[model samples]
Target: MFLTHGMNESGELVSVADVKSGHTNLHCPFCSEKLIARKGAIKEHHFAHAGETCMESKSTIQQTGLPFYDIATGIGKSDIKLLDKFQRYDNVWLSQKQAETAMYLTQGGLLEPSPNKPEKYQLTRLGRDLVKHHDSLLQKKIILPEATLQEQLFPARLAMLQYHDEMNGTQAARFYQLRLQALLNQHLYVLKIHLQQGSTCFPLIKVGITSRSELALRISEIKRDLQQHGEVLSIEIAGLYRHFGSLERLIHKRFRASQFVIGSHTEYFHAIETAHDLSLLNLEALGKRTVEGAYCRTTYREHAHKVRVGQRKAKLLNNTHLGRPAKNAENLLTDHPDIVEAFHASLSLRKANTKTGKAINTVRKVYAALKESGNT
Candidate 1:
């Protein structure tokens, strides 16, 4: 239904939505509607069904582990054993879904807690596929957590000292916080947020880690810094590294899969959004959608990962009047001896229609340029 965003006492922005990191079944937050219709009359959102409940208000978010829930739903294809990666996020977690969603978001945005529930947390799903793939595919690709880094970060005091010696207190804190990321990338536990509130007034941030020793030392530092300066409110270490990546895959694949979940939840969650934007639900409009992705040259520089060779890529190729010439045109032509002949042949076949002709001509010119440059 509606999207909700607000600032906490700490001034950090918080957003609430049906599709938020902690939510399942992308409903209209306000009305609990499965669909939303933005009211042009006012900025606020409403349900597609006028009489239904609207989105959840700022204070209404239930404390249940929801991200974990979403992950479980999407995990239809992954292994069941993979659920262990999420245990670190919530010691009391009892469901498969919460852990899965939590794992997904931890990689996308930094996970944080509801001030109301300091022990619980939510984050962006950076690498979210371990739970979404079919068992065969999931089982074939997975990795386990690294124990060494976990040990290194285990000693809070030591890490604190290294952090201090390696960087200033501020920088040390930052580095210590980031230490969990290494484990996370490897599909180990992720850092959980420990929510603590203070009354002082210094710029501060919350950090999370896996080890108690490390957490203890880091918390002590924050407390000490605030007490000494008498200028900052107490900062919190709300969470620590729970398990990372898809555990089911790791167990099945024996940690041999790729390091990312581009096709996992991260991919699909994004796909749900992007598919709608790129898709033409109307069968009649399929060509339009295809054309949009393809010939929509407006964004020639889409992210390397985002732009796969889809019909859109082909459409773009079809619409192009100019080929993207090779950097070393001469060398390309020389290296590929058939380039000149192909270009000439292609050029001769060009029709007069702008759309198809443009593409053919583009190929012709690009190769021609290369041939001429190569001879130079």
Candidate 2:
């Protein structure tokens, strides 16, 4: 007899759809014998035992302690109708007959009271999963012998368990786990904020790690501390990685040259100077390890071009410097004549201060001196 489900080396149930039409590393869930995948064009896909089938594979037994089987057999037509109706609507007010069926399903952990309204009902996670995989469940039932209803129904439970196991192995799943290990145990956050230094307002990028659960509260604390230095124009989250402290360290190391101190904090970097780091962050977000591909190179080029264009616009509109702050008026006027020209062209200082990039104090002083000396 052909089986629709087989167990892999991990002891997780796998469907015939998961493998190709060849001898697979799959064992019969009932007899623990090697199985062959049959995926011919004419017939339905299934798994057959490589050797003679065992007695258990041929006969049907009343299997207990299987949630999927119990749920599938226990629910009546009315219960299924109610579940389908709830799936279509966000919240449902069941009729008296439907309500009776829903009450039974609720006790069986399929339905729950809606969060928004206590009187209304909603499908639980298990109910949603059943609804989502309804067709697949029916297919499994159709392939199995009529007597082996338990075998047919139990595959859904096994498949769901396998899915849960796979998800637990993912990076996202590891992120949510509160582990005692030091590595990959904190959230890495890239924060962008405009820092006002004298007459200059420039964008400062902060790369740091935190173990806190409430990120909003942490951001609020940061805003409060930074408010004394600047107006705290906007505190935007540029990048976020759960349990990525090592990556945070790598980012800090990459842009160490651009690092600057603001009060007691030292994780800050000049936004324009370290704009290339954006590409790295973008790649990491996309789950790419290497920047060797044409796509990655294009991403780098795009970021560089955007930084250059932003620098030019910042200088023109706000007289903001790009790389670093100028120490003296001679250097400010000599290096960036365009910035001085913009201020002398009657650009409002308030408007200039609104933009963020680099130092603007020296540019302001140079503009004032030039205006007073009638050198404009």
Candidate 3:
């Protein structure tokens, strides 16, 4: 098989697109042998060993030292789905049909039998790494479309947007484009938290965003908070994301009907009742334009509605003829209440544009008005 990814001198995965067709310095990731880039128009670009093909590259069973690439390279879609389930939930009991896939993951060292329940399986360190590094691994694929790679990287791109007191038209356009990309790339997760209220004990799932680094700290905080009600029986990370605050708000809205409030916390929902809707939890499906898109679309509609309201407010303020016509800069500030609120909250004009869906010109005008008024 042709290698889709090669390792650079720095030991980072390099796709065929990252290099030109020639005797390059890239090495086969599995065998560490020098590789030749083949970017001919006749076939898909990939890496071929300059010398004889190593046994490791020829066989799927051979160790590559990169467990994620080694395990992911051979797995089918169903197998990947099974792995996702393990990553998202704790103590996953496999069906007879799923058992075959589970066995493959277990043999690949991605999963292990649950200590408490042998029938159940849990993600091993390797398995967790596979899911965590999924985006990077997907980018290394020569077969996957560039659009797909961009979609997967949408969150990172959005998170990198720089916030300034004022932004130009181009910056505003880039911000809006990234926000739209974020809507399309929403990745939802179910976090199962075991809670005890009075004499009854049950599991409550919270749909939200959290990174791997913060997950342990979050669980610890939850455990500390529930000390009065009852000890947290268990907590499991069903999924994770980086800087997905917008996605979290959308999820809260989607699952609002199923929300259950415990004391001051309203984020929890009954796990048993929410299980029926869990079929929508497929990571691959969520990343595509599916049910997740519907949720994001609803959010976009809300934003659009707010924008229309702002425009109407601007029109009304302009035509009010209160004593004298309001200054254009002051009118913009009055029109976009969200921008005013953002300013009151000490947010920069660039951030206000992002938060309020206001145009860069509007944000700039409002910001100037605020500056003149000594309110900034």
CA shift at 142, candidate 3, in angstroms?
28
TM-scores of all predicted structures: 0.19, 0.29, 0.29
Q: 126, model 3: CA deviation in Å?
A: 39
Candidate 3 residue 295 C-alpha distance from true site, Å: 20
Per-residue CA lDDT of model 1 for 189-254, tens digit only, reads: 221222223552222222222223245654564455334434333344322333322122222222
lDDT at position 357, candidate 2? 35
Model 3: per-residue lDDT, tens digit, 286-324?
222332421232123234457667767867988533333
For all candidates in order, the CA lDDT equals 0.32, 0.57, 0.57
lDDT, residue 5, candidate 3: 64
As for lDDT, the candidate ahead, 2 or 3, is 2
Predicted structure 1: clash tally: 58
The TM-score that candidate 2 achieves is 0.29
Q: Candidate 1 at 6: error in angstroms?
A: 18
How do all the candidates rank in terms of lDDT, highest first?
A: 2, 3, 1
Q: Where in model 3 is the C-alpha error above 4 Å?
A: 1-189, 211-214, 242-245, 287-376
